[model samples]
Target: MPVFADVDTGVDDAMALVYLLASSDANLVGIASTGGNVDVDQVCRNNLGLLELCGATAIPVSRGADQPLSAAMRTAEDTHGPAGLGYAELPLHQRELTGYDSAEAWVRAAHAMPGELIGLVTGPLTNLALAVRDEPNLPSLLRRLVIMGGSFDYRGNTTPVSEWNISVDPEAAAEVFDAWGRAADAKVIQQHQLPIVCGLNLTENIMLTPTLLSRLAAASGATTTAMSVLDSRGTRSTADNTLIRTLEDAMRFYFEFHFDQGEGFLAHLHDPLAAAVALDPSLVQTRAATVDVELTGTLTRGMTIADWSHRWGRESNAHVGVGVDPAAFFDRFIERVGPFARRLQADR
Candidate 1:
């Protein structure tokens, strides 16, 4: 129930963090702000601001490296907005970050709660890779690890054959996968539960629509205003619930971005679905695979390769998500977050 989150604080990352906070079973122990959707400094700011918004300011947020392990850091401002919260504006909080760095945070959390921590990473693998390097036994320390990255047997969202997170730090991603494989080969893992990888292939299916957003608002017992594709691009939510209003504003930008990309007027709740899977792996059906990252391919760098047939002759490092029920996930999301938002509104 102790959840350790590493996030880039993108609009979807904010959703994931809020989902964890909303879940009754999740005790978010710490947050590691990594560089991806925005800079590390901005990520820390977003994390602090988000905690303040949810009135959960006690969570310790740590900062990670500003750049990737091997490549020049690239941010997705066009996708996540300039400040990484989309169109929503959270109040700037004066909360300071944790004393130690993110890698140390990971090690300390795992040590403090040995075999009881659930690790969820919704950004590039830079911080987690550094943590694994610092503590070689990190793979066995967590009860479960869920990563939101990569695409297996599916088209990529970054380059022609690369996903955003992995493409930003292919070397770090490769190192993390290799570390898990090494741990498995050494037979050090007790549960043999490989990291559940929520790749783009499966996550893209968890789309968010205006109707669902309205349903969430109504579930929160708020005065809801329905969002529509015919509305203005910068249309804001008129929900009575503050949390729902913020989410609606953020998701409006996301919806427009996806529509511009010809996807539709819907946004994929990629990181939130990953966060859900971390708490309940039964939400998704996974296949064991020796997952690796392509680092030097001419046109496929950062491509995630899943050896589902033992072609690599190595131990499986990841349980690649093969199938899921998007409706079930949405139901859980609304059921959990709606009441949480209602409570926050009542407190206000």
Candidate 2:
């Protein structure tokens, strides 16, 4: 089985968490939240609420960094709403807060596990960076690091060149990439231990299909009901309605808030696709490359530079996902999430 370490602060991040909770292949050790879409405190609360919603309250939730490594912290409230979860009012589930620091919890979890554990990062890399700095052996303890960040060839949703997660913490991202490079170069890490980046290029292929949304609507419990009511009241739009309309009208404006300059009926399910790739690598097309984070450029602060030129001819440290079989991936995702949806809906 695979143990998980999550760093999240997005609405979609909650969906990804729920998916992991439902998946049989994943054993959630602990969760660490970083400041991205909201404040660190809110992200922690959201993480706890998500676990309760998924009936995984036994899992521990910890708060992470409130700001980025260097630059001023930014948030995506315009897209994810004020409270995250699209302002949907979920019923409160009382949970006894854990006493462990989020980063410390991660280290402890790694130590407790018999072997390497997977680090599935769905948000900014701040917490992971802190963990690496605190515990130098953390990377070696990890079986793999599947990160949802960056953009290779596609235009970014945050900026013309920057993806949200990387844009939020470029300094931390640089550190993580460098560490992965060092470990891979030394051959101290297994082939699967290298970081697998599920960037916007691959995630853009996985759309929230109508059938899947219908399944989610049917699967979600009181949370879905509350969301539907909120959608009706115009507080937010349901994923089903937003996705269907985007596909139908070709406007594609459900999640795009930074740049309103796209013509195709496509929105990247960036975080969920990352989780899917972590669950099964066969869903994507991968190529090994020396992926670097651009931190000092005037216009490319968070751009992910995949060294595909083969000039230096260095051993590839990163597995960059270039493409995905959207049909096959979505089918598998629906198949896996479908039962959980039904069970959750029934529980409600």
Candidate 3:
């Protein structure tokens, strides 16, 4: 399927992008950058840089919101590091930023592919909100929308009641839910809405362990090309090993963060699972809900209010994640993703 990605390009976001690019199922048409993990400009660089590394620079990329729709931008530098890739590094590139407005890029991609386009959003919903504002029929245009935010049945990561992506831009999130018939003013979903939400509640199930990292390392030995994203001239590093090395460098910080969280040297992959669910909704169990972003509560702002029980007598607008098989999810990921990484690594 043609996939349009909106990303903040943090570590998890990078993981998601790499997974999508490596997957045989996803035809990543474009990426719209947003400010969350880092600044919007930096996120653009990260997106392009990753493409350059994978030798997939042909994909279109553009800058999106530099700030949220309303709230002040709050980046996760402490979590993803100053560059949003932790300690991982990529060579600078002169890749052109294609669109003047990210909303245009988003809507254009949908229009080009129409019902075949699958949207994967792993950041604040600023670009999507802008696109929906431009085209109210956007929900009907997309085949499905998979988002990596919220904590419906679990606690928050940003604050007592917020996930980083939603907390950073509750207004935009609210707009998205409203458009999809998940907010207070939302109407009932018609016939063509497929919105699946993969929140921390479900993503926290599959944590990245050393075992998975070892498998990833083994798959990182794919071929490479002379053209490096770091520079026009290819650097002297072992071409076959660059991919694995890059992941390792970035994940060092991620592991430490999880260790401190008492998770024992492991990181919960929050975004990639959403990408996976975008391709196959059956990967996780869910409940129908009318979800709204909490914007007024001093202690609960940015939280996703998913009425799993139809508490408000509203039509369900989203498939809110409730459960997933951890071992099965990881097994499927490694089995499918491992071979693809090996193929991408061989690009050079």
Candidate 4:
């Protein structure tokens, strides 16, 4: 699969990038850095650094909008740490971003690939919305689109009804969904399909526990030190494999954050699960709906509403994810990434 990802590179976003690199079938052509987990500048740095760390620096990284479309920018530094990688630190290699900005990058990638690109967005929809505005044909150009955002009949991580990515830029998300609705209604291309939306209702089930991390380290042939809640906060992994160590350090902070939130010591592998679904949509089962974002509700702003019953009387714009097998997802993750980490250690 030829993949182009737009992301605000936080801990789970980093895991998604690494997962793409590790997948044998994934050909990651480009990455667009957007603002959500942190500033777009920091997101770009994290993308470059992770690429360098994974020995996949040839993929182009592009800078996106500095803020959201119609709201003040908000960042989740507390959730993802100040630099957006939790306790993990990666050196940003001396690499230049793509000559064009992120929106242009999106247009160029889709044009160049021409029905061969799988588009994945795991951040605010600013870049994609801008690209849609500039190139109205973008929806038909991609082979498929998978988004890691929104909450379908589920409690939001950001608010009672709003998810983080949509809440960050409700206007952009609204535009994106509206554009897709128009495209679906138009039926411009014979191969056009509605975007697969991996909402929190399904993604929150893809949890990352300490036992899984230990299994991942063992698979990498690293000396595994199992993480425990009993350990002091900020305890870092001592895994010999560099990749395992980096991910463990990153996930530990995520675990503690979730624990403090009363969600137990498990981290939701949100973005990575989206990445996986991009490659294999059968990993999840989705329901078609007319998806739209709430922009002006006092208590429901940024909420993604799915008109599953066609009350809105519009074409279905999204295939909302409602079911998944977390165990199968974890099995796939460990199988692919563990050996990739071992190979990285060997190359070093």
Higher-scoring candidate on lDDT, 1 or 3? 1
Candidate 3 C-alpha error for residue 16, in Å: 0.6
Colliding residue pairs in candidate 4:
none
For residues 168-254, what per-residue lDDT tens digits would candidate 1 score against the true structure?
999999999999889889998743447899999999999999989988998899896798889987887898888999999899999
What is candidate 4's CA lDDT for residue 62?
97
Give the range of the ten consecutive residues with the poorest summed lDDT in model 3: 226-235
Tell me the spans in candidate 4 whose CA falls farther than 4 Å from its real position.
Answer: 189-192
lDDT of the candidates, in the order given = 0.93, 0.71, 0.81, 0.93
Task: Report clashes for each candidate as comma-separated counts.
Answer: 0, 1, 10, 0
- Candidate 1 lDDT at 143 equals 92
Encode model 3's per-residue lDDT on 4-119: one tens digit a residue: 99999999898888888777888999999999989999999999999988878899898997789988888878888789887789877779999477899989998998888999
Candidate 2 or 1, higher lDDT: 1
Q: After superposition, how far is residue 194 of candidate 2 from its true place, in Å?
A: 0.4
Which residue pairs overlap in candidate 3's backbone? 91-230, 222-345, 222-346, 223-345, 223-346, 223-347, 223-348, 224-347, 224-348, 225-348
Question: How does model 3 score by TM-score?
Answer: 0.91
lDDT of residue 26 for candidate 4 = 98
Models 1 onward score TM values of 0.99, 0.86, 0.91, 0.99
